[model samples]
Target: MYQLTLGQRAQPTSPCGTSTDLRGGPIPAQPAHPTRTASSPARVGRRRCRPPPTDGYEGRLVGSGLSGCRGGGGGRGGDGSDCIDALGRLLTRILRHMASELNLEMRTDGYVRVRDLLKLNLQTFAKIPLKSHTVDEIKEAVRRDNKQRFGLLEEDGELLIRANQGHTVTTVTSESLLKPILSADEVSVCVHGTYRKNLDSILHQGLKRMARLHVHFSSGLPTDGGVISGMRQSVNILIYLDVSKALQDGMKLYISDNKVILTEGFDGIVPVKSPISRRHLSPSSIREAKP
Candidate 1:
């Protein structure tokens, strides 16, 4: 914001000018210092010694023209104290803009992912004047706000955030939703009551047999013994079919890892990999699998 100024221009002079005529003559010498008179005893006590008058009296008295002249070291303003304050205000404005953008995005999305939201939040926090609060404190504040705005809640003790009336998405806690299905010693068929009913059915059944059925619930799924494989941990599975009827109906069992679970409602079945067949099937085997 600082600008430079130009000095006044000099008029053209004659080629041969005489002193005291067109050309300027040398000025008489002036007193180097202001003469001081003898002072009364009371004034003498408060009087300060002055520096010797010299050609560069102003420069000497002012010390270096740099900002270090005052008690403060050289700063952004060169010699004035205004620069630091101006810089602080500029930084505050930039950070405020960034914070505003982040808040807008969060509002539009209803629920922002933890990882994605941290970048902007961290930037704003870093610019805070006080160093007493840490990045973690800022993150906690953001998390609390997000939870309040989006109805975020913990699923299986893990953070699972969602917007109000938002579709329930699958997460690492989905496995907890399978407790009801697994608890039944008898084969139980599960179904998604939401969208894509057929697709959900096939996926759930196939994923279940392959030990891939994972469901997430508001309350954690039960993990009692005798639960089916793929139903003990976090998974996206929505429906479970009670295929125990197939075994009781005298169907010849050709169990293998490649076997797929099929329900009467679905036209086709999905492929899945099961760790154990009927001969060695147990809740422990399914529980041990990695979701």
Candidate 2:
């Protein structure tokens, strides 16, 4: 039989009534996989539990901090670090790519019932062990995602979740993405931060999506910490977006729930003819921005 060692979690009070689907139809939460634990095995006729993968996958348990994980449950160090990070990665993949796989609408908002996500993680899509996580832990992982990738929704009192941006599926509309362009207008400038090494390529080829969808940009550099998510070493340059020009040119620019400005995709993987301002950010300048 399959073996599951993850600890138990208190199921949140799921309010009654089905949530409205993309078409406003009722879609209720009907979980395919019930919670399992090492102490309590599934029935003899049921599926056998496979032990968690021993590789780094088991090194971290992502959500709903359980008591039975490696490195003593889900704090910030040891397995906790690995667990949350894995959850982030796994969720990102699923959010950005699951529409076609799951037979979902292109712009259906990428809303997956929490229970369905857990079932998918435990069975279908997972290739590693340590995929176990509780709904609470999943929620925590969403909260911790640095790029503001995932967004939570409570529809008709039924909790639902979705990716904030970076969707290849066109089923979603700008209104569904929300935050409004008026909000985008309030920003003095939006910025894209990248390492200094890529400046030449970017200047020549422009910032390409490479894969997935959307060209991610930060609304602005924060006063503390590194601007945007991935910045290696201490040196990087900032590319200021011409938001007004982009909008005027009819480019479909969007702001992620996390305040990052993104485009559906750039033409020819190069920036628009829109006027973009550039600046050199030294190590000292970044340090000075910090509180």
Candidate 3:
């Protein structure tokens, strides 16, 4: 976990400021680039954040920093859409992976005060400062997000934000971060999505929670009305779980604020069972895995 010194007393010792590596080592300075003449406006725009990889957890973290952009060219705040997109990605990273690392005390349910989040001396890859971001911009990011990945609230007089699910931090527990589905009848459909390439491994070894606290499931299919989070839009393979059976067997399951179904699984693995079924995205296709 990288701890970038927060609070007013910390001063920048480098081009942006003193930033530590993930291991807390001093990051080396980069070589100087040729300066552009004033007549030629720098054409750099904010670096677009990358999407999560197909294999999901095995993939490296994406969407960490904004790439430097300037003027009408790519740069932080230069393009309205680009700025919001970058901001959304950054928010996701902090709320999902770096709350503890950055020392922004998060609630057990995973919310962090928007004011506290704004205090961090965030920067783009081009060293563009991000501390100027306003609370309204943060609200816009949440409103525009397609996945409904973030949840926002007004506690007393302060605004708070949190990733709806997909947490990797040890500090957040399933009991704290999620709403339990006490009755098996509460969940009509619980499906996990994945790429067809991972199908064989999943069938053989069952679904592992990977680096996350629980295996994520969707209440419905992508095309199903009211379905938003949980499964990715691009997944071709869906694994249907017997939530009732799992519940009857004493396994626990939960639902996040964004409606994602979750379970730690029995010993962290959802074994193949007779009630569990596999289906392609196509409506006509359905099959059961061998128990």
Candidate 4:
């Protein structure tokens, strides 16, 4: 919930202007470094650091400014840490809580208008001290998140943005959501990890979507990069999905672009624990908890 002030007004201030600290106090200036003479040995091999983008022009242009274009690099446009973080928080809060308020049809594919989001105000963002954001700043936030939570796309020459998944609102009409687990055998090992304490209740009551639209699972654990599905890493209890049985029982599942497995448990699915289910826990927890 940090207040990120990007693009300070063109008023009297230093060249880079001043960045504020958490306490709303100005950050102290750094001690001036000694100027190096032309003969200084250190200057021989030193590479120059690029100053941050002014008015958003950059060596990496497509990914900078308000153009809504794409390019390569380490997923940054410039020294934009504060703006990106603010936009990211703003995007998630809206898509999850206020997506439909602005009259967009969000789908399982996660496409919405970048311009619409940029125009969001404190009313939508729980009144987070929002300043105006540009299209590029929003896209830069999407790239830095790297979770694929939000994305940018081109449709009929217009640029749009969306939350990748984990939507509690906004109906998704993506092709993936329309299809069932066509090859259950290929997804035979899908699983969800949880803390050791939840095993007893989970084993008794079964996994539920709870507040979310679906219960997320990964193809494997985080080391494999599939099961990272936005869960905490310390999870020890692994809930294995019997996709075959799940489909056979008339349940549905969707696979996200990021390879995360998703399911909205069948109607009345909660309270109906599977009698024939597969689950595992870390070896160390086996002795500490019930089998």
Candidate 5:
């Protein structure tokens, strides 16, 4: 019911004069998508096969001295060119694999990682300005390009960035967000209600739970309540509760170990440091020391 052409199922010829498939398997009855006729002079001249071009990507490839054979320079040229094209296709496959494995969303200006590139032997395709460039030079070039595109630079050999806004907002370190709340001593909790009845109920509940601590409620949101001020041995706590006809407010609690010092509206857990003491001197000595 099915028919196959000889050229369509022909196996590719290996350099060793044996038929081979693309995966190095035994030669099939026909070649896949044969570009050259069987009687074509190019096929009998020992020229290598060129890989088909891929869509949406472009690159160049170079070969080492081993690519050429003795005599027949034209044949060598054709073979070398074909080898380069094949290498380019392989490199493209590597890039695709890296993008998929690393969860990298490739943009027109974006690039693959140097580690991934090296793993795929992609440095071979990079056109070095000099005929002989060192490995370090290639690495540095890749690093510089990656940093410029990603907006993150290595600081003291560490990758550091204030924020990365790719799909979600991500902070460089936890200290950026957690420090303020951890270093507070006395927190003022404020509650507000849209209606008078709701305010009265909230105030009564606050009084029942926190008789010793100061609590306040008003018709609108509290303004001066979130501020944590001069806390020695941080002992105060702040709780805010809001109830309305539309949404229910949540409750939260905080615990501290060190003295919380709230200054300039920033809260953070501060470590103890050596205190500065005033130097003692006699009145006559102080007068003599004055210039």
Candidate 6:
């Protein structure tokens, strides 16, 4: 059984229909995993769960507000923190990468039925099974997510959930997943955060989407009041983009529902204009900083 433990929050919604695949066909029923009834003996003597290996993923729980977890019960923190964290990571993977592989019907706009998602037999590092997760628990997890990585929608009485951005599925078109920024003024400031180690390559080759679908940018600095998500707090380098310039150059820029600035980066390469090498500076400092 896969254990349930806290994992790195990964860096990175919709409506409609009776849980159908991208091709609009009904999803095959997933075989159910055996369940432990309330009378079952509790498994004990298991070692305390450890932090998951860093996968370069980013994001943080906004708060420890989860009241309970259904699968395997208590987490490492003994307060459902582990279970919620694990659930969030699992949701990210399935929604962003494995929808096709798992045969879970993901719509073109990147939404999957909440009921369909809860049917998978996945588990956490603590051996907590995901099948036991309640819709309320899943809802709570997404709500408390600091990055606002997921968006929830209710349609025709069915709950739908989706990742706001950072999708690898090519069929999930930007036109479907993101809202187009029609004017540069739609976003006041656009900045891409990175590390010093990547500065040289980025300065020369520009920022690439790498494995993800779009290059992410923030509308403001992490310290800025308007900033919610998009950039990680640990990034030491900040590359500010001229939104107007990019727009004028015929670049397509988009903003996720969570307020993340995203773009294809002018054919997978967003040429860097100037990179600021510090993180503590204010939003206005980017304008004053020299290359």
How many clashing pairs per prediction, in order?
17, 14, 9, 3, 10, 9
Assess each prediction's global lDDT (C-alpha) against the native: 0.25, 0.50, 0.63, 0.50, 0.24, 0.66
Q: What is candidate 4's lDDT per residue for 126-195, written digit by digit as tens?
A: 1122324566666677788856676578888878877666666636653533245666876645666565
For candidate 2, write residues 1-291 as lDDT tens digits.
111011111122325435532211233443344566764322111111232233433435446264223432223344455455556656665666565675533335567666566655232212223235566767777888776678887778656678876665555665666455544456655555554456667665677765436666665555444344322122245555556666665666666666666665446253633233333344446433310
Task: Write down the lDDT that model 3 would get.
Answer: 0.63
- Clash tally for model 2: 14
Each prediction's TM-score against the native?
0.17, 0.59, 0.69, 0.61, 0.18, 0.71
Worst 10 residues of 3 by lDDT: 1-10
Tell me the spans in candidate 2 whose CA falls farther than 4 Å from its real position: 1-81, 102-107, 121-131, 169-175, 182-184, 222-235, 265-279, 286-291
Worst 10 residues of 6 by lDDT: 1-10
lDDT of 5: 0.24
lDDT of 1 by residue, 57-81 (tens): 1232144332212222123224322
Q: Over the full model, what C-alpha lDDT does candidate 1 score relative to the true structure?
A: 0.25
lDDT of 5 by residue, 179-204 (tens): 23321133332221122223234233
Q: Is candidate 2 or candidate 5 better by lDDT?
A: 2
Off by over 4 Å in 4: 1-78, 101-109, 123-131, 173-179, 226-230, 268-291
Top model number, TM-score: 6
In model 5, the Cα lDDT at residue 147 comes to 15
Model 5 residue runs over 4 Å out of place are: 1-79, 96-98, 102-109, 121-291
TM-score of 3: 0.69
True-structure RMSD for candidate 2? 15.7
